[model samples]
Target: MTPHELYADLTRSGLNLIGQALSIFDADLRLAVANRQYQAMFDLPAELTHPGTRFEDTIRFLVMRGEYGPQDDPEAAVAFRVEQARTFQPHYFERERANGCCIAVEGAPLAQGGWITVYTDITDIKRQESLLRARSEELSGQVLDHAERLAAANRELAATNAALQEAQRILTRTEARTRQVTEMVPAHIAHVDGEYRYTFSNRRLPSIFPGAAGNVIGMTVEQALGAPTFDAIRPWLECALSGEAQVFEITHPTSGRRIRIALTPDSASHGVYILSTDVSAEVQAREALSHASKRSLAAQLTSGMAHDFGNLLTIILGLQGRLAALDLPGHAAQDVQATLAAARRGATLLDRLARISGPREMALQPVDLARLLRDVATLARPSLAEGTVLDLAIDLPDGQVLLDAGALQDSLLNLILNANAAIAGPGVIALEARFSGEWIELTVTDTGPGFTPEALARAAEPFFTTKKGQGSGLGLSMVYDQTKLVGGTMRLDNTPRGGRVRLRLPLRPIARQMILLVEDDDSVRMQVRGQLTDLGHAVLEAGSLAEACAMTDLPGLTMMLSDIQLGDGLGVDLDASLPMVLMTSLPPGDPLRARAQGPVLTKPFTQARLAAALAEAGKRT
Candidate 1:
C-alpha cells in the first residue's frame, strides 16, 4: 500500500482505541472523516456516519428523536446547532442524554478550514459525584457547585490547549516560508537595531558588496560594510533612524558596482529596514546617454559657424594658390605662399573643431592591444631626436580589446609629440601598455620639466596651452575629450623623471573574421569592398539580403555590412547569424538611422573610418 494509505489506516485504528468518539468536518460543514466510536456513541445510521454527510442532517435526526432533551421546536434546535458549527469556535461542554448518560464534547477548528470534535462518556463519573454529594454531610451545596464548575473549566482548558498547539504549528510553517522567500530575492533585505547592529539579514551582503562577509547577522553596520562604505552612508543611516526614510546610490569599492539602497524606519521598534539592489549597468547607460546629449548640443552650435568658416577659408586658399602660381616678385610670391599656409592651417583647425566638438560617435572595434602598442612605438620613433631614447614596453596579455583605434592612435601620437617637445630632444620617453582592472592602461612618460600647478589644473580645457606660437592648445583637450567619448578615463601627473599621461579604456576582446559586403549599387559596393579589403578582411559581395541569407552558411563570413534601403529587400530582415554594420546616407536625425544600435558607417567614409565601423558592428551580436 501507499504510505498515505498506511498512515490513514494507522490514524483510524488509533482513534478507535482511544475510547472517545471523534469526527472531522470540512469548511462546508460536510463530514470528512469519523471514527467507529463516533457512529456507535451517536447511534448513527450508515448514511449519516459516512464522509460527505451534511452536519445539519445528523443534528436534525438527533434533535427530532429528543436526543438533546425535549425541545419546544425541533427545527429551532437543529438550526441553532448548525449556525453554531458555522462559526467553528473551539469549545468544550457536557450534556446529559435522555438515556441517563453524560458525555463531554470538545471541538476545535483546523488550520486548513475544518473542525474536529471529540466525545467521551462520563456517565459513571457524574454518578459518583452525585453520590458523594448526597452521602457526605460535611460537603456544602456551594462546594459541590464549585467542584462541578471546576471540572467544566478543566475541559475548556484542554480544548484551548489543543487549539493553541495547532496555531503554533501554522505560525512556524509561515515563518519558514517567509524566510525562504527573503533569502531567494536578488537584492539584499535587512534590519538594523537602534544600536546599529544587524538584527536581521537575508545573507545577501556579498552580492551587494562583492568582498563583504555573508554571515553578518549580528555584525555592526560598520563591521559588515567596511569603513569606507560605512562612512559614506552613516549620515543617511542616521536620518533613517530619525524616522525619515532614505534612498541613495553608492559605488562598491572592489567590484565597482553601483548599489541603490533604500532605508525605511521601523517607527515602533526604532530600527531601520534596508533594501539594496545593483544598478551598475543603469548608471553606465545613463552616463553614455548624457555624454551623447551634450555632443548633440555642441554639434548644433558649431555646424552653422563651421560651415560659414569653411567657405571663407576655401576662398582665401583658392586666391592664394592662384597668386602663387602667377609670375610675380619674389616677396609677393612668398607672401602668397604664407597666406596659403595660414588658410590651410585654419581649415585644419576647423576640421579639428568638428571632430572634438561635433557629434562624432566612437567607432569601437576589437583591437589587439599588444600589436597596437608596437605600432604606436613605431609611429612615434620618427618624431624623436637622435639624442632622445624611446622605450616601448608590451606588457599586455595575448588578447584583443575594444576601442576606437583611430582616435586612440591619434591621442597616443599627440602624447608622443608632447613628450618630445617637453624633453627638448635629449631625454628618454617611455611608452607602456598593460591591463588594470577592466581597463587597458597606456602610459606615456617623458624626461622633461613637469607641468606647473596652474597648467596641470587647466591642461584638459579647450584652448589652454603654454606654448604661445606653435601649439593650438587642443591636443591634450582632444585626448581628454576622446577618452570621455568612449567611456574611458584620462589622467595626467608628473613622475620624478618626467611628465606622465595615462589613458585607461575598457578592455574588450577582438577576433579577426571575414566580412560580407551587401550593396545594390555597383560603385558603392566596389568602394566598400575595397575598404574592407584595406582593413585586412576577406570580403564577399551580395546585392540583396536574399543573397546575404544564402551566404550565411559560408564558413569564413563572420560579419556583414549592408545598406538599409536595399534594392531587393530591407537589410534589417537579413539573417542575424552574422554581426551587422549598416550603411546609410540618411541624416543623423532620421529615426531609422538614429535608432540603429552598434556601428553605422555613413556615405563617403574613408578606409580607416570603415575599419572602425566594422569593428563596432562586429560587437552587435
Candidate 2:
C-alpha cells in the first residue's frame, strides 16, 4: 500500500481498538470519521456508517428504530437532533436506550469547524449504583438516594471535563498555527490601544526597521520604536485612534530605508491596527522612473532648438572662414578668426547640451579602482600648469567594483580640469578614493581660492559657470547628471584645504570565486549553474544541504551559493567559515529570510544580480 493508505488504515485500526465508540462530523454535518464500535453500538447499516453519510439520515434511522424510546413524530425528532448537531457545542449527557442500556456521551467542537463525539456504555455502573441503593440496610433510604445521585453527577462532570480538555487542545493548536502564519509575513503587523500602547505584535519590528525591538507587546509606541520614529508618526496614530485610517511613508533615520506605514482603526475595540513595510527598493525605482521621464521631456523640448541653433552656427562659421581667407586688414582678419572661434565654441556648447538632455543608459562593468585612478591622474596631469602637483590616493577593498567606467572617468576628468583652472599658479590637486560603508566616495580637492558663495550655491546648475567667456558652464552640470544617472550623489563644498567635490556611488563589486551551488530543485540548480558558469566561475552542485555539507572538504572551495530552504537543513546553518550567498523565493519580510546572515537573492534573478550578490558575499569574508 502507499504511505497515505497505510497511514489511514493504521489510524482506523487504532480507533477501532478503543473501548468507547467515537464519531466525528465535519462542519457540513456529514460523517468524517467513525470507529467500528460506533457502527456496532448503533447497529447502523453500511450506508449510514460510511463517510459522507448525512447526520439527518443516521438520526432518522435511530429514531425509527425506537432508539430514543418511541418518539411521537420521528421526522421532527430527527430534525431536532440534526439541528443541534449543526450548531454543535462542547457538551456531555447520558441517556437510556430502548434496550435499557445506559451510555454517556461527550462532544467537543473543533477549531476548524465540526465536532467529535465519544460514547461510553455506563449500563454496568448504573446497575451497581441501583443495587447499592436498594440492598444496603446500614444506610438510610434518603442517604442512599443522595449518594447515587452524586455518583451520577460526578460521572457527568468527568465527561464534561474531557470535552473541555479536548476543546483546549484544539484552541492551542489553532493559536500556534495563526502565530506561524503571521510571523511569516514580511512586515510588522501590530495593534495598539487608545493609550498608544502595543497590545499585539508579530515580532517583525526588527526585520522592518533595523535594531527595532523584536517583541513590542505591552510597550508604548515611543518606547518600542524610539522617540524619533514615534514622533514622526504620532499624528497619524492619533488620527487612527480617533477612527480615521491613515497611510503614509517616512524615511527611517537609522537604516535610511523608506518605510510605508498603514494605520487602520479597529472597529471592534478602542485600538488601531498598524502595518509597516520597508519600501526602499520601490521608492528607488519610482525616483529613477520619474527622473527618466523628466529627461525624456527635456530632450523633446531641446531637439528643435538645438537643430536650428546648429544651422545658424554653421552659417556663421562658413561666412567667417570666407572673410578670413580674403585679403583683409590685420585687425579685420583677427576679428574674422575670432568670429570663427566663437561659432565653433557655440557648436561645442550645443553638443554638450544634447548630451545632457538626451537619453543615456549606464554601461556598468567591473573596473579596477587602482588602475582607473592612475589613468585619471595621468589624463589630468598634462593639463596642469607648471609646478602644479596632482596627488592621487585610493583605499578600497581588494575587488573590482561594477560601475560605468566611461561616465566616471569623464566626471573625474572634468573635476580635475576645473580644479586646474581654479588655481592661478603652482598648486596641489588631491584626488582621493575610499570605501564608505556601501558606497565608493571619491573627492577631488584643490589648493585654490575657494568658490564664491554664489558659485558654490549654483555650481552644479546648467549654464551657471563663473568662468566668464572662457568656459561653457556645462562641465559641473554634466558631472552632476552622470552621477544621478547611476543613483549616486555629488556635493560641492569648500574645505580648509581648498575647493572639494565629493561623489558617492553605490558600490557593487564583481566577485569571481570557486562556488558551491546548493539547491533542492534539479531544474533550478541547472539554471543557476549555467548563470554561474556564464559569469566565469567554476561551480560545484549539490541537491540538498546534506549533500552540500558532505562536499565541504573539497579543495579550493572559496564560497557557497545556496538556497535558503534546503531539504535536509537551512542554508543559514551551513559552514560559518565559508562565505555564503543565499537565494530564496520567500517574501522579504519572512523571518527566515530576514534573519539570514549573508546576502540573499530573490528567485528569478538574472546573472547580473547573481554577480552582485556574490560580490557582497565576498566582501563579508
Candidate 3:
C-alpha cells in the first residue's frame, strides 16, 4: 500500500481503539470518517456509518430512533440539527437517549472548515445519582443538588480538553511554519538575553558568519561569536538592551565579508532580536560611487584652476624658449634652462591632475592582455632610471578580455615609474598578471624601501606623493580612479622587500567580430575604419542610415558603429536589429545628441573609446 493509504488505515485503527465514539464531517455536511465505536454507540447501519454519507441522513435516522430525545416532528428536528451543524461551534452537552444511555457529546471545529464530535458514555454516573437520591434519605437537599451538578462539570471538563488539544495543534503548526520561513531567509535571525547569551537562533549564524557554530542556542555571545566580532557588535547589543534599535555594518575578519546587522530591543521579552545579512557587494558598490562622486566634485573645483595654470606655464615656457634661442652668457643660459625645466615639470603635474580630476570613463573593449602588457613594459622601460631593472611576468589565458587597453596601459606605466623612483638606485621591479577567481589580478612589486605607513594609507589620495617636488602624486590617484570607473578595485600594500600595488579587474572576456561602420564624413569615417581594423575587426563602411540598413542584412553582420548625425538622416532611426554604438560631436547637454539610442560614444574619441563603446553595446545585446 502507498504510505498515505497506510497512514490513513493506521489512524482509523487507532481511533477505533479509543473509548470515546468519534465522527468527523466535512464542510459539505457529508460524513468524512467515523470510528467503529462511533457506529456501535449510535447503532448506525452500514450506510449511515460509511464515508461520503450525508450528515443530514444520519441525523434523521438518529432522530427517528429518538437519539436526541423524543420530538413531536422528527423531520423538523433533523432539519434544525443539519442547519446547526452547517454553522458548527464548540459545544458539549449530555443527553439520555431512548435506549436509556447517558452520553456526553463534545464538538470542536477544524482549520479547513469542518468539525469533529466525540461521544463519551456517562450512563453509570447518571444511574449512581438516581441511586444516591433514592437510598440516601439522611443526605441534605444541598448534597443531592451537588451530586446532580457533577455531570455538567464532567461535560465542561471534556470540552476544555478538546479545546486545549486544538489550540496546541495550531500552535505547533504555527511555530514550525515560522521557523521554516526564518530558515529560508537570506539573513540570520536570532534572539539574545540581556546577559549576552544566545537564547534562540535559526541555525543561520554559521552561514552569515563563517566561523560561528550553527547550534548556538544557550551559548554565551563570546562562545557563539569569537572575541573580534563580539567586541565589534557588543556596544550595539548594549544599546539595544537599553530599549534602542540600531543598525550597523562590520567586516568579518575570517571570511572578509561585509555584514549589515540590525538589532532591536524586545522590552516585554527581556531580550534583543538580531538580523544580519551579507552586504559585501552592496558595500563595494557604495564605496565606488562615493569615490566617483568625490572625484567629480574635485574635478569641478580644479578644472578652471588647471586651465589658468596651464596658460601660465605655456607663457613661461614660450618666453623662456625665446630667451634661450638667443646667444647668452653661461650662467644666464643655465638660469633660462632651469626656468624652462621647472615650467615643463609644472605642466606635467598639471596634466596629471587633470587626468585624476577629469570626467574619465573606461572604454572597455576586447583587449589582448599579453600584447597590452608587453607594450606597457616596452613603453615603461624608457622612463625607468638607468640602474633600475624592470621585469615582466605575464601569465594569462590566451584570450581578449573586455577592458580599456589605453587606461590599463597608463595605470601600469604610472606604477612602473613610481616603483622605479621608489628605489633610489639599482633595484628590480617585477610585474605579474594572473586570473584569481572572478578577478584578473595584476601586481607590481618593487625592491625598494616600500611605502611608509602614511603613504600606504594616503597613496590613492590626490597629490599625496613621496617624490616631493619631483612627483605630482596624482599618478596613483589617476590609476585608482580609472580602476573604480570600470567597476574594478586597486589595493596598495607593503611587501617585505618593497611595496606591491595590485589591480583587481572583473574578468569579462569578449571575442573580436566584424563591425559595420556608418559615418557621413569621409575623413572621420575612414579614420574610425582604420581604428576598428587595427582592433582586429573587419569593417564595412556606409555613409548614410539607408545604406547601413541595407548592409545590416548582409550575412555575418555582427554590430553597427555609426555617427548620430548621418548624411541622409539620424542613425538612431535605422531599422537595424544589430547592436549599435552611436558617435556624436554635439555638446553633452544637447537634447538631440542625448536621444541616440544604445550606448553613445562622444565624437573626438580614441580607438580605445570606440572599442569600449562596442563592448558596452555587446553587453546589452
Candidates' RMSD to native:
9.6, 9.7, 11.7
Clashing pairs in 3: none
TM-score (C-alpha, index-matched) for candidate 2: 0.67
Candidate order by TM-score, decreasing, is: 2, 1, 3
lDDT of 2 by residue, 315-369 (tens): 9998998898899999998899988988898898888879978767676667888
Which stretches of model 2 miss by more than 4 angstroms?
135-153, 192-200, 211-231, 238-243, 265-272, 304-308, 321-345, 357-359, 365-400, 409-437, 441-504, 510-621
TM-scores, each model vs. reference: 0.59, 0.67, 0.56
> Can you write out model 3's per-residue Cα lDDT over 180-233, one digit (the tens) per residue?
999999999999998988888988998889878889989988888899999989
Model 1, C-alpha of 431: deviation from truth (Å): 11
**Candidate with better TM-score, 2 vs 3:** 2
Off by over 4 Å in 3: 1-276, 289-297, 512-621
| lDDT to native, each model | 0.83, 0.86, 0.85
Per-residue lDDT tens digits of candidate 1, residues 1-621? 999999989988887787889999999999998999999998989999888999999999999888999899899999999999999898888889888889999998987887999999999989988898999789889998899888778878888898899889989998898889999999999999898899999998887787788888889988998999898888999999999999999877555578999999999999999999998768767755654565566567778799798999999988888888899999998899889888999999888778867556767655776787679888888878878888898787776666788899999989998889888869998999877766678889998997778877778766678887788778987888788777676778898987999887766555666888889999999888876765567888988778877987897678888898888887767777668888899877777776555577788777656765665665566
CA error at residue 323 for candidate 3, angstroms:
1.4
Count of backbone clashes, every candidate in sequence: 1, 1, 0
As for candidate 1, its clashing pairs are 401-508
